[model samples]
Target: MADLTGSDLTAAKAQDDVAAPPSAPRRGGAAGLVRWDTAVGALLAVLLLCSFGFVGDFGNTLNLSFLIGNTLPMAVIALPMTMLVAAGEIDLSVGSVAGLSGAVMGSLWNAGMAIETIIPLCLLLGLVCGLVNGLLVTRLGLPSLAVTIGTMAAYRGIAQIVLGANSVTDFPQQYLDFGSGRIPGTFLPYAAIPWAVLAVIAVLVLHATGVGRSLFAVGASAEAAWFAGIRVKRLRLSMFAATGVVSALTGVFWVLHYASARYDNATGLELSVIAAVLLGGVDFDGGKGTLGGAIGGVFLLGTLENTMSLVDVSAQSQTVVTGVLLVVSVLGPRAGRQLARTVARRRSAGSGSAPAATG
Candidate 1:
């Protein structure tokens, strides 16, 4: 009878253990901001609803199309910039790279080179520009921020040299139409189709692949990632290159969309991209962000700017608004995290102080 009783107790214990769920990962630092990302999405939805009701013609098709079209240049660049930041790096030169690519497109067109040939060459230039930035940072062990700042100036100067105050406005009508047209009876710009495809590719790469895991790992701790056999430098280099290539592509699109190519295209685009990424809850320090959140941030800013424009807000006031949001993005998460920790501590203390149940 005793042996049977012991066996029964042991079996019950084993069953209870098996029934327990596995422990979930504790949120830490920026990693805890996953909830924050969702909050931004919700806020964006609310803002859109309010705008449609309060702002005149904001719901109309033409205004909506302009909003998406103007926002796209920054939005597309934000995609790769998110990944680069995820891996704990940034490329300020992206705007200049866009400008340089456009300048080259203009120069080649002026030389009577076929548009087809010039495009491929422009893409190749992007790869080369990216490689140069990657090499400087990876090979020389320089800080990426400093290196990119230098390159930003150099690239823009080269753009000036290439196009020399001239703009190229003539391109094949078909290509121009693709850049600036919209689908019938919808708010979707034709350029948005390609951007949507790229967004999907980016989402898959960041959220569902080994490469994505490695980026978070590196951003969280470069030394640890290296110890775990990740090719840290190689990965960083590739990310820089990706930023370059995408920015270059955006430049080409910029030229066609505006029907002109010049040295100064997308001059301050990096600011918008970085601002949107951070506002999306991507930790500026790295190791935490979602592409979904980043994209949400993009549209939020775009919408706000569009509404402001419709309301006759001065350009300087809009700049101030963006600056204020930038400040909030940096501080909001840290404050929320602190408040959460305090609440958790209070709960723990209250539970500990509770009296035991009567026997």
Candidate 2:
């Protein structure tokens, strides 16, 4: 009887142990645990609904088409930028690299290079630009922010020098069509095809692969990732290069879509891209973002801009709106995290007081 009773007690303990789940890590507090992507997604949906419902002619196919097509370039750049931020770095020079690529293409075309040849050369130039940024940061141990900032000015200046107040029209019609054409019954442009493809690729790479996991690890702690055998420098370098290439491609699309190329093409584009990425809930500090969230961010801004344009909002006011949205994006998560910490501290104090009272 004694033995059976002991066995029963052991069994009960084992059952309780089995039933209890492990606690989740509270690294960044409640906000960290809360998926910002879902929130951003909901926000996007509401914004879209409001636009379609309230804005005059905003729901018309032609207007919708133009909105999507115009914004496609920014959307495309946001993909690699998402990964770049996920890995805990940024490339401010993307806009300038894009502008430079466009300038180079225009110059090459005028200098008797075929459009086909000019395209590849432009892509290569973009890759080189990326490599420079990556190498300078990784090798010289410079802060990416500063390095990219300097490069941004340098690249944009080069672009201005190359094209110098000149514009290029007369791109091939078929290519132009690819930029401006839309799918039947949809506002999505054919230029969005590459964006869609890259977005899928980015999703898989960021969320699925071992390499993707390494990016998170590196972003969280570079030293730890290095100890774990991840090549943090190589990964970052590759990402920078990828961003450069994609931005250059966006430049090409920009030229074709607008039927013109100028040195100022894609000016101030970097801000919009960064804003969308952060708004999607990708932490500026890095290692905690999703491609889906970033996409939601892109569409949310695009929708907001389109609606505002339809309402005849002033350009200055639109800029202010974007700035406000970016500030909110950064602050919202931080506020949540702070609240979580405060709650945790209060709970700890209460628990401590309860023990003393019992004593």
Candidate 3:
């Protein structure tokens, strides 16, 4: 063989290293599952324990059913909210949209429209609301935060205008039964079943599809994505539409469950949905979260609220708790970043000192 020169030796070594670098250790089954949002899980476990200790009958499945029933609508809305956030947008109008959709459906039903017409009409309304949001943000170049804030007020106002203080209660028995009904004589709520199914579908779409990956990419870096030929505007619009549609679905479910539709339906729910998404490990800055984590966040919030309610905690205090959690969730990542920097500094110092020690 010919004598190896310095450059040739360097190149050979680089190629070999690239071919045979050490593999990172893999987490095993249970540990792997817990790795996604260990913090959320810990909070949930502690809440569960406290709930059992403080509330009589909290251990029963019926209590769980009640919690599930209440939380299902929020969960459904949050799924699409997760996608919107992942795509670097937010929809503050979801609560109002949900309310409006329910009001519309109720009004139509009270007027004797068939269920078929009401359902499609509700879905179409969602699509329209979402499209408007998308237009304001994407076409007009308005900030989504501002646009959604305006729409939140506008939509809720529309809901009030539509129903005033009066409520629509003459829903068909089939809807009422399905909405408030449990699953086939079990304590499992029917409302929760649809939400669960929707959550699974949303998760699969967000995690297992190309569109999902692209949404994340756009959120992570919109300019970069645009340069890479992704249609950032269209995707953002679609996500907003999806959020509206999901919120509408939840609204319909609400009408079914309560047997009444009112302007106040799902009021102030936007915060809870966003809280669940953030607590689930989706960064507020965008482009990082899992559907499973969002679901976990929903469960965490649901448990906290249910436990609090059982103990007679005031709604105001619960809001405070959610606000605190939101702050902590955002801060936790910052704390981690600070800790990483500290560790990196120490490691650098150690490596520098190592040279002297060897010398």
The models' CA-based lDDT, in order, is 0.88, 0.87, 0.82
Candidate 2 lDDT score relative to the true structure: 0.87
Instruction: Estimate the lDDT of model 3.
Output: 0.82
Off by over 4 Å in 2: 1-34, 356-359
Per TM-score, the best of the predicted structures is 2
Model 3 worst lDDT window (10 residues): 20-29
Ranking by TM-score: 2, 1, 3
Instruction: In model 2, state the lDDT of residue 100.
Output: 96
TM-score of each: 0.87, 0.90, 0.86
Candidate 2 residue lDDT tens string, 1-359: 67765655565445434332222124346555657898899888888888888887998888988888877887999999988898889999999999999999899988888999999999999999999999998989899999999999999999999999999987888988887888878877887777788889989999999989998888888899999999999999999999999999989989998988899999999999999999999989988989899999998898888888889998789899999999999998888767655555455444445444443
The residue pairs that clash in candidate 1, if any, are: none
What are the per-residue Cα lDDT tens digits for candidate 1 across 210-265?
99999999999999999999999999999999999999999999999999999999
> Which regions of candidate 1 are displaced past 4 Å?
1-34, 342-359
What are the root-mean-square deviations of the candidates from the true structure over C-alphas? 7.4, 6.9, 6.1
List the pairs of residues colliding in candidate 3.
Answer: none
Superior candidate under lDDT, 1 versus 3? 1
Clashing pairs in model 2, backbone N/Cα/C closer than 3 A: none
Error of 2 at 11 (Å): 30
Best-fitting candidate, measured by lDDT? 1
Question: Candidate 3 residues 73-144, lDDT tens each?
Answer: 888898999898888889999998999999999788778899988998998999899899989999999999
